[model samples]
Target chain A: MDKTQQSHLLIEDLSVARGERILLGGISLRLSSGQIAEVTGPNGVGKSTLLRAIAGFFPVRSGRMSWVESEAADSAPLAERLHYIGHLDGLKSALTARENLEIGLRFLGRDRRTPLQALDRMELAHVLDLPVGYLSAGQRRRVALARLLIVDRPLWLLDEPLTALDRHACALLKAIVAGHLGSGGLTLAATHEPLGLPGTIQVRLGTR
Target chain B: MTRILLVIFVRDLMLARRIGGGGILGLVFFLSLVTVVPFAIGPDLRLLSRIGPAILWIAALLASLLGLDRLFQADQEDGSLDQMFLSPAPLELIVLVKCMAHWFVTGLPLVMLSPLFGLMLDLDGPALRSVAATLLVGTPTFTLLGAIGAALTVTLRRGGLLLSILVVPLAVPVLIFGVSAAQSATISFLTPFLVLCALGLASIALAPIAAAAALRTAGE
Candidate 1:
């Protein structure tokens, strides 16, 4: 992955609401270059909601979410600058894994690796030509994660990235995230299990 | 920028060619609708020819709406819609490209085959040609209009029926102009035809914007 130097993410006193109710509130966090924030919380604690909120999928009632790239703030919109891996795997079942990743690479407008190389990194190159529907649940999840490798984005918002992954794939994900962070990329993952990477920031929400 | 839009367009066309996603359903449904009309009118060649333009317009309108119901919903269900939101390409352009591919598969074929459907309904040479020509300019309006309905009802289960209900009423003007233009093959061919073209252009400009707005809210 290409190095993303001097990128930073800061969320201050963020409050996200749904309809008439506030799902979570009073949250604050900062992530500079080469760091990972593991958002851990009990179920229904708005873990996924926070990730979605940052990705601009969920509504934020109050907060100043800003990004600074290369010593200059007010860079690209966070939606275009970040990657969000939600629960749905985000792959079209009719298309092969290679096609899905290629579309992602083009649409994301940033390229780090070819679909072949990205899948191989997750030990999933053999399934490259297979339709995503044919892949098992774990394989599909790994293919979805390969999307992260194809794009060179500064921030990653992952919701339960470890789900359905076997031990090997889980380790693969951790190494991928670690490599990403080492390259000066920032990541925020909502996970039940530990990412087990060093210096992982724990942002627990919904305490109130 | 063109490359990104082309990628989305190609992916959608590929899906629509696949088994369950194929546009053959729309074509076949169109053929069936045309086929049943002759029988319903009891072999009255004069009546069939007289009403052939209306039948073709209505059938094409319904057929084009077939593939649109899943235009955004399938992407939403698979999580690709979120990735789309994150893309540098504008969402309205994305919606337009997807709808273009959709119309290519579902709408274009119907336009090409409508002359044959017209022949089956005892239409004359001029009527057949005019029907095909008008559909080329008109079917896209159905796809564009249906896109709004599709995006509005995307998160709802069984939105296909609701999509029809919502879009059909709105498609009346296009239908009226389309049928009139086709039926006017022997008369002033330019008037209603131009109006139909204007409707197509207007929908092409505006539907994507409206559909994209609806999709933005549906993301939550």
Candidate 2:
């Protein structure tokens, strides 16, 4: 795409490493608004690392990851524009599902009502008052996904979001991603299995 | 906001209660140490009284260090620490909130229960008051300094012992002033109290940055 047509996320010749170990080297990709980029790779091919780098959670050892909000070309701070979810679901186990959602909302500085509605949409109302430690793995995963529903950021970076989730939860998450894309929000998700998301653009790493 | 701090403070206290024994174990250890000193000295009440303030301060210092290992370990293991780091609020704010919560659960309680230890150590009324006041100012410094050590060791396999080693030396200045203030309160309180408050304020300004840097190092 031409520069004018690329007012979105661009990862150009990016390289990252941890000490002497190179996590990813000379990788590049671009993601436009309203598009979902599904990153597929082997287990240790630095998929989560890539997502984290894009979200500014980790530094790019070399090269650049740029975000253009509008006409401006320089990249903004990654945290300012993206919502990132790593392998470890970030939920307070001692807190009830509702309280966990509330904390997530406060973190995003979004409305609590929206998070409550998200919990309802996920069909988690029955256990909203139960501490997350009491919930099953699938339920915990759903609570994490509920964060995606309530947060209003334009970009989502999720790693292995479907892990441990049941068919219903998986389908629910896919639908949420689809809705997010339809609303001009972008997504960069890394996963081992194909998510069966319709019209997603796939970026295969490790092999190429 | 104070409300946010209060919520975090209460939550941590509840967790400390449910976990049971870690927070109180330190106080119990402090009590025993204070009581055992008289036995070791062979009925020297004069010496005990003279050294009582310092003894109480040292005991409080060690007791505060008791649960330092768990400051960020549980949160890191559970992924809540990562969430806090990523929250829209600045990471420094999160560090402050977490440290304040920790102080409430561990340090504040020790300060509250310190008078009994003072009495056992034959600390006079003025000395006991000094011990309490110094702890009120000093333990927060202890908590803040311990945060850096906790953050640095949070990801290590052998974290607890290493954290204590790293932090106790850094906390030496605070302990010095803490005990000094308590010991001198019988005759001259103002100078030591001012010095202790200065140490606390300096720590309040610097420790958060150090802790944040340590956390970033651990993350890398």
Residue pairs whose backbone atoms clash in candidate 2: none
lDDT of 2 by residue, A120-182 (tens): 878787888898989999888888888877767778888888898888878888888887777
Residue B214 Cα positional deviation in candidate 2, in Å, after optimal superposition: 1.3
Candidate 2 stretches with Cα past 4 Å from truth are: A1-7, A71-76, A112-114, B1-14, B17-22
- Binned by DockQ into CAPRI classes (incorrect, acceptable, medium, high), candidate 2 is acceptable
Model 1 pairs in collision: none
Deviation in Å, model 1, residue B174 alpha carbon:
0.6
Error at B115, model 2, angstroms: 1.9
Please give the CA lDDT of all the candidate structures: 0.89, 0.79
Clash count list over all predictions: 0, 0
lDDT of 1 at A202: 92
Give per-residue CA lDDT, model 1, range A8-91, as digits (tens).
Answer: 899999998878898889889999988999999899998988898899987789988888787465467889889899899889
